[model samples]
Target chain A: MPTNKPSLKGKLPTELKVMERLALVEQFLAKLKVDFEAAGFRRNRLVNDGIADGLNLVSNAVELLAEESYEDADRICRVAWIRAHFARAIFDAEMTEHFLGEGVFLELDDGGTTDWRTFASEELAELQEEIVNLRKQIKDRSAKRGKK
Target chain B: MIDDVAKLLSKWLSGQRSNKLMSTVVEAMTEARQKVRASDSPFKSLARKCIDRAEDAYQEAIYQLKDGEPKLCFQHCKQGLKYISMAMLHLSDLNGNATTFAIEQGGADESIIDLSKAIAAFKTSVEYTNCEVTVEMKERLKESVRLFFLAVSFVEREDDNEAKRCAHGGLLYVYLLSKESEEKLQSNAVDAEALERCHGSAISRIVSLIDELSDTNSTLQEASVESHGRIKLYLDAARRTVDRCISAYLDNESDALSQLAKAGMMELRMARRLIEYAKYPTSTAEPEEEPIEEVDQPTDNFRGRVARLQRLLRDEDEEVAVVRRLGVVNTYYSRARALFASGELSEAERYARSAHLDIDFARQLLLDKHATYSDLI
Candidate 1:
């Protein structure tokens, strides 16, 4: 049976907690990558194709976290999170086009086509809820650790 | 014998139209008076008696000029001018102006007080006298005196080029004055001859002084140029080394980063030395020895280089918080290095990432502003 515990010996509880938080960040990044790809966004062409608008901020955060500068890492993460929302909006627009057709979402607003806006709104709401929950979890964990 | 000597003195004073020859005779008479007193001669008072007769001749010349007797006035005025010139020559040794003149001859350090006094004497000689001196002559003498003082002041301030310029101006004014004096007294042969005899030697002395100052100015300018060239080379080398350091750091080449930082420090030191040399081109101070803290330790060397860069950046006047941003990068980089050295790989990686991000931001801002790294330095 696999365990959630780190394999490294003599790990402090705080270090283990930090490791857990980093794992969550990695999961979010991985999900973002997959979603970006599913939306026809190339990983290498994110900067050139203008798909992953917040990739630079994400990359900077990843580098800062690796360098053990938590403050700078946190700062870049906030910027990346905000940019990720913009990326999601772009993804949603692309998805609406791929699913229905170009201008179909606009037609839905004028009562001339399918109600895809409702679906997009619901999807965006779910994504926002997940991001808010994750951000709150990180903040709560940090506050608790600071108190200790 | 005393009466015979007095008669000859009067003849030299009245018959000779040349002030230079008259001055020479007066100087000889003065010297003979001193010699006679030293020899215990019973006729020691004879030389003193001759000077008194010369003074009496000057008084007679003034009276003749007032009486509208141009011929007698010319004779008396020539004698009068000769006496005044002799008096000034004797007083020049005691005055501060003499000290300034001595500076040109490499005799002593110049005193501004003495120089000003000398200039004042020249000015006063033209203005204070009741004698019928020409306005053009007085104006030229005043200008020459002013230029000479200006030149001396420039020399005191170590601006040799300006000193040379002022000296040249003084010489030119003296020449123009001489020409003007000659033109005014062209019809009067006696007066013209007397003016030339008195002022010609003075003009020649000024020319010689200016020539000497020009030589000194050229030597100083050469030294300044050489020092300035060295400063430029050092600054260029410093800039290149700093660029290499930044590249090495970005590439994660630790060894190259450390080595480049050391090289940058050396170039900065050279630049500082060259700047000082440019300021004091004649300074003979030895080059300072490098600190032992810089050598035999890569970390310390890197820190030293960073400190120097910080100092250089802080001294710059920037519209943005460039120094603060660079400081943040440096802080992160140092933390990363320390963590990495201690085997905390994950923690070190995070700090290094922050450093890189900050560096990128700084570089981007600099680029956006169309400024170079040297501008920060």
Candidate 2:
């Protein structure tokens, strides 16, 4: 009875817990690296430069984790995660249109060029799909982490 | 539409038909095409080979007709007819049965197509704001779009004058909207702009809601000078509801807090719509038996802690990371929007406040990241 263990009284199921949203952010970084390489997109300026810059937040997150600043590390990574998700979705749509021979080069606020179609509401369903999958992934990963 | 294209084709064809060599070939192709009138033909398989070639050539010729020389257009058209004739000869070898249908081509003037597409693009450009317009300006915009549609219809009939008038009407509304935007933008100065000017804070800073809500209140107070009529009533209701909600939050009355939150949200919505409606400029002053919402100096009634979140959201331009300890706050706003769309407003509001901690905990977290988060889920 004096064991230094959490009792199973009035506890919510571990599977329903939502704390490990960071798990999804980690996976987002991993996936982006593989996707860019597979798509033959070099992580540099002139192509996906914003995403490349944003991905640096993950390294910062890891460094904070080493320093035992879990909350700040999570915040940093989560910011990077959503920002990266947006950049990835935009780039994915742009690349799709390019491959389909329907993309146009639009000028950015900064005098850069992109293959993003100016009118793009059709691909929103794809965005919702990603969000759903991400939620599922978060739940599963959170459950796994709770075991430790 | 057909008459416009046919005039061009008939004028060209009659000239071509004059040549003796062309006359003989045209006669043969005409007979071949006429021979394929059967509804059910056993020799359809035999005729298919030549018909495929004929259709391909005809399609290619149509594009040539769009831009290339009339000579190339004619050559491709003739190539298609030759294939049809060969199909006829092949059908004759199979006891003269065929299932080939007639191959006809038509073209609209390129300028007409271009103009129609341009009108569609104009329709899209109008939905987006030139700054933010008043409702009267939007009513004018609605009329403008109506005229644009009329322009599209007129262009279809090739009535250039009617189309020009409609297009001009649409552009005039747009011009008025621009003028309104210029006047509106020039006249009012917002406190939030000053807040935004405090750099190293663009979408990155931990926001304090007190500053933003005060800014919003001040801006509304400025606008409340004009005939806000019933909007003032709604704002008053919203502000009171917010105060009650904050009290409920402190008293641990979750049920009352939920009801008060929803009531406050509704009041805010009505206030917004009424403001837009009241602001619509007309020739005469609106007779308000009820006086407009009077903006008072920071009274005891306006100050509430948790209530500020409701007001802060109305600042659509508010940075997401305003409060400390953003436990999925940004995504919650977005998720709440989606849930709102799916007719789940109750759940949406819950999600929107998904990061709310105990008041004391929040205060501590504001100082540092050491807050109890039992309510996050």
Candidate 3:
């Protein structure tokens, strides 16, 4: 037990372990090289063009997100999170009111053209009901059979 | 009274010889429920018991249908039909049970045929009944007959192309009609009864279609053809659904409803797997991973185009005309992208380059004209 050997108890099954590793690899490997190139262009624009032009650069960044390519979707998700964080720093209260009132939220939504919240919600509810029904059936059968 | 109930039951059952068992059973159950609730006699107990059994059987059948087990669903529906017929029997056996209304309604099961025959009969029926039939009744009968054929077809051999196509087309037509009805239901334009009839038919047809392909007995060739036909059908249904959702959302400026369109796309991708499998008959690997669900619904926003061009243009009046060129460019781009995605790379490149050329022309025009909003560009 004290030997420098692998223990099966704490480890994932070999198949599952391989699959988990593969999933991570897929995520990293599938990323587009175009995003990095686009980010570089955006950074250059911000430095050379001032805030208004910087805003335009950000708009371009958002456009890339709207492209709906898998890599672009991931990048957009990350950028949206980053922009929300950055909003507190650069946008003053009055500016924030104006920016968010009719601007940021709209742009944020515009970046992600597809909204799947409703169908997802409906499907999840149906699935949950089915699972609950199955659980009840199992419980009833177990009780009838005098099984723990 | 028993004689009267027997006469009514016989009449109703005979009437359903040309109509759907489900509709007949549902109607019978509703009337039985009301009669039991209204009556206080000891015979009411038997009526109540029969009604409850009928309901259970109907619900069980619907559940089986949703589970993608059409054979099981058919069994349940058969059971439901039996229970309903029996309920009518028991009600007839009662001392004073006679339906007040005339029972010879024409909505009986008039067309019963094998898959191919059912297809021709359905189209003919629709055409013939176009003048005499109410829109609601036409849709209801069409949906029910389609589902019934689909359920029966699933259990049959699929070696014949005619039978297969009949099943495929019938299911597709029903799905399209049901989806249209579902939209009306969502908009509060149709009642639950009509919606349920349409919805149930769609669900039943879809489940049967899936079950046929997934059956252990199905050959890969059988699955391939069926799945390919179904993909086209499903894509068309998805497009129509998305179009309705988009039109409603845009015209009303309501809350976002693009999610339905996205979900439809996801479903289309699921069907697309079979098409891909058909292309590579020898591959041992599973189908290619589906595209991420996205609301790729194309919107030709002429106004948005005008606004965008206005920002780029120096001439205000010329902005509208310039917008048309942008549409041409966008269409070429979209077609190219789609062709490329479908693995027709040469055609894709041609269309892509065509798009590039049109975009350049528009850009040059904007620059040359020095459009009013040229400063912004």
Residue B260, candidate 1: C-alpha displacement in angstroms? 1.6
lDDT for each residue of candidate 1 in A1-148, tens digit (9 for 90 to 100): 0012112333332422332332333233334556666656323222122224344544454344434555555434333432333233334444544454332221101010112234223433333243234334444554665798
Q: Over the stretch B99-198, how does candidate 3's per-residue lDDT look in tens digits?
A: 1111111111111122123223333333332324345335333433333333323223222232333333333443343333332322221122322332
RMSD (Å) of each candidate, 1 decimal: 43.7, 28.9, 33.2
DockQ per model, Cα: 0.00, 0.01, 0.01
Q: Considering TM-score, which of the candidate structures 2 and 3 is the better prediction for this target?
A: 2
- Each prediction's interface RMSD? 44.2, 31.6, 34.7
TM-score of candidate 2 to 2 decimals: 0.21
Instruction: Give the TM-score of each candidate.
Output: 0.18, 0.21, 0.19
lDDT minimum window of 10 residues, candidate 3 chain B: B101-110
Model 1, residue B92: what's the lDDT?
27
The digit string of per-residue lDDT tens for model 2 on A1-148 reads 0001122333332310111233333334445556666776323232265456455664454445434455555445434543444344434534543465533422112111121111111122223233344344445544665786
Q: For residues B1-377, could you state the per-residue lDDT of candidate 2 as single tens digits? A: 89989978975774454333334445655565566655244444434644665566556656765663455555556655545644554454333311111111111111222222222222223322123444444444444433443444444454545454444434433433333343333421112332232223211111222222223344454444554545566666555554454345323466776676666565565555555545554633543333333433222211222233322221222233323322243345355545645655466555544522322333344335355655433
Q: Tens-digit lDDT track for model 3 on A68-138?
A: 23333322222222222222111222233242333221111110011222322232233324323433443
Error of 3 at B315 (Å): 14
